[model samples]
Target: MASWKFPGFLIFFTLFSCSFSYTFTITNNCAYTIWPGTLAGSASPRLSTTGFRLDSGQSVKLTTVPGWSGRIWGRTGCKFDTMGIGNCETGDCGGKLECDGNGAAAPTSLFEITLGAGNGQDFYDVSMVDGYNLPILALPKGVYGGACNATGCMTDINLGCPTELQVLGGNGYQVGGVVGCRSACEAFKLDKYCCSGEFANPNTCQPSYYSTIFKKACPRAYSYAFDDGTSTFTCKASEYAIVFCPNSNGNQKPNPAPASPPPPMRRPHPKGHVVPSSSNIVLLPFPVPMLLLVVSLSFSFIVERPWPVI
Candidate 1:
């Protein structure tokens, strides 16, 4: 009887733990290799890995505790030694292979998320507010219900990047071509572009010509500092897939996919919620009764099973 009790409790514990955690599947769908980096928010716990090399077509899974909040980005044109010491052409974090809590540099596409606690909706978005280094697509998987619309910027903004804001590839890899597109604020540090100083309020700060260019190209991505209305998304999902340089068709052409409709307006974020400058945060109650029922049934079956006496 004692041995059976221990096994039953272990099974229940495992299932309960799985119910609360969420999985992030990070994939490199680009033609070239990319090193992905992750940065946890000041209040959130860090993931198991801060960064790692991911070759084309490779995917890695990362699990996070409930309510984990962080940002993920890809670094391109990286050259590292045996000790993983080197820098990437774009999205480099302190010139190290493993970012180790370092945030990505400007001019990089970012996938930011603030996961909710048990049975709560997650807020996520692919942001170009920092700029655009590579195309990114974020898709939520295993959504129990509610609006789990896919959000991302698949357009290769570098091709049409304004000359002043273009980040040319200094390395020989992309010579004579733009490798990244800098935001107007990043290119020119002004009150209007940066949304700082007296222009901090949404009413005072408006979109610039450069921001319009990005918004027109990628309708779903966050083009500027306060692009929350159309850019932020919420979903109660078991997993999320963040694809870097996603190839929609069979080829490498960076064709944009049809934008998903904005999610229905929901309640505002709870008090004390940390809203990032580039995105507005929100939450929804997750349906956990069904999940709990399934776990309970499994636990009961395990406990009732007749065991051969040792």
Candidate 2:
């Protein structure tokens, strides 16, 4: 007699099949300048592809990673290093409020604006990955009111950000007081940042276009801004209350990702079994060949059995 077992031959043997597919969209929340030069990350820009870059009024449809995350955008001018980042420079300051960070050229000042949230009660700094902190916003044709008046206060003034004060602090290593406003503004809120209604009202002011925000930072001290060690702003903060302009206002609740369910539990097995499936099975190419002899003999005996045979 011979014995054999074929996957628990339940009341009967049956066939089955199944298939599935998954699709997704992605967005990168953090990344470096699209390109870097002799300054820092000049070796490779691969890790820099994480975020998206847009000019004054440009937009893009993100499709890499999905879900909302904090993001930064800018339109760098001359620092347009073909393979490097152009730091603060005079030639192109991305319209003044931003930095051009070019190696050879001088730093140039461009546009500046401030945006706030709430009644502009209390303002906070926008923290950056490297401890570099700031608030952000986008301004159009930025403006800068010159030297603080005799009272160390510049009032109701705007002169499209000054190229004179435009300084790139990132590469220099160290600078003091509130760093001059970097060409870019930290993300911020409209209510948090504000200019005196007395300063020019948005509606009344002559703007190339409207900036999401436009207000001065530390409007008390001589109002002039100074650069910090990290290419950040402290205002002539030490000199006087620095009143730098800004654009970003990170005032809203940053969006969050929905929680994902834990993956299905799988049991441990001595040896993983190959699940049978109707779709994957080739109709005749099974272990049937090995069972051929046994099946034939069983059939012969059943056919010749006395009870039903003549």
Candidate 3:
């Protein structure tokens, strides 16, 4: 027997006085949030807990939270590791692909952080186990950097829109869902970061891949930092706040240099005259609830053992 947890509620309903055949569809006479998951119309092809098929006019009252821009015409795997960036011919890639976020424009609203059934509407936190799907091709610009995971953006892929296309020229780590992204000239402090969480989730991965990705991405704390796909640039010793920029690459030789750092912790204010303007700030606005999701080997061992000859 196999059991899994994804707040997907499958409902098959039809509208209009007609009989139709739909490969996939969702229709209901009521308004119910689909797992209350984050639905951003961006470029990262995230794991969707609630994916359904529709036949033409059928509807799911997702107006309160909004579903994908258009429709769930077909299913595809994660964008990364799909051989080619925009190629997702398979149904589910099974975490083999890395995730790069949409580059053209960011999601226009607070698409992250819907609380659980018990939690209030003001509930949200960075996802340690799941993310949303973005069809980059659907964006007006046709490209993106990627959403930043707790670790970093994985890589570039097609926008999870109605078309298939490729757009690059980012640090390959802009993939992010609930956290602020680190594309362009953005900067972040690590101390105030809530990126570090479980290094692995047994519920999502096979025993082999779980151990491999976890071992590789573990040891290092998870964070959505300003990175260049080759290195994570956040200051591990200090709190961080991100400021995104348009031209982050060093090649754009423009404008006079900004004021240089005088020295470490050297403020212009007089001694003992602390100012409110330079106070501490939280990098991410939303609060996270869960701890590191990485399961220990002992926990892993027990899960695999299973019921004894039940």
Kindly report which residue stretches of model 1 are placed more than 4 angstroms away from their true locations once superposed.
1-19, 170-176, 248-310
Q: Give per-residue CA lDDT, model 2, range 103-193, as digits (tens).
A: 1121112111111111211111221111111212211111122211111111111112233222334433112322223222211212211
CA lDDT, every prediction? 0.69, 0.19, 0.19
For candidate 3, what is the lDDT? 0.19
Top-scoring candidate (lDDT): 1
Model 2: CA > 4 A from native: 1-48, 51-53, 63-75, 81-310
Candidates ranked, most accurate by TM-score first: 1, 2, 3
Q: Measured by C-alpha RMSD in angstroms, how accurate is candidate 1?
A: 13.1
| Cα lDDT tens digits for candidate 1, 270-301 | 22234222211122222222233223223211
Candidate 3 lDDT, 1-310, residue by residue in tens? 1232222221222222112211111221111111111222232123232233222122322221111111121222224433633323222222222222221122111112111111111111111111212211100011123222222111111221111111222323222211111211112221212122331222221222221232233212111221112222111111111111111221221122211110001001111111111111111221211122111111211111111111
Q: Tell me the deviation in Å of residue 55 in model 2.
A: 3.9
User: Could you tell which candidate, 1 or 2, scores higher by TM-score?
Assistant: 1
Instruction: Give the 10-residue window scoring lowest on summed lDDT in candidate 3.
Output: 261-270
Report the error of model 2 at residue 121, Å. Answer: 22
TM-score of each: 0.77, 0.20, 0.18
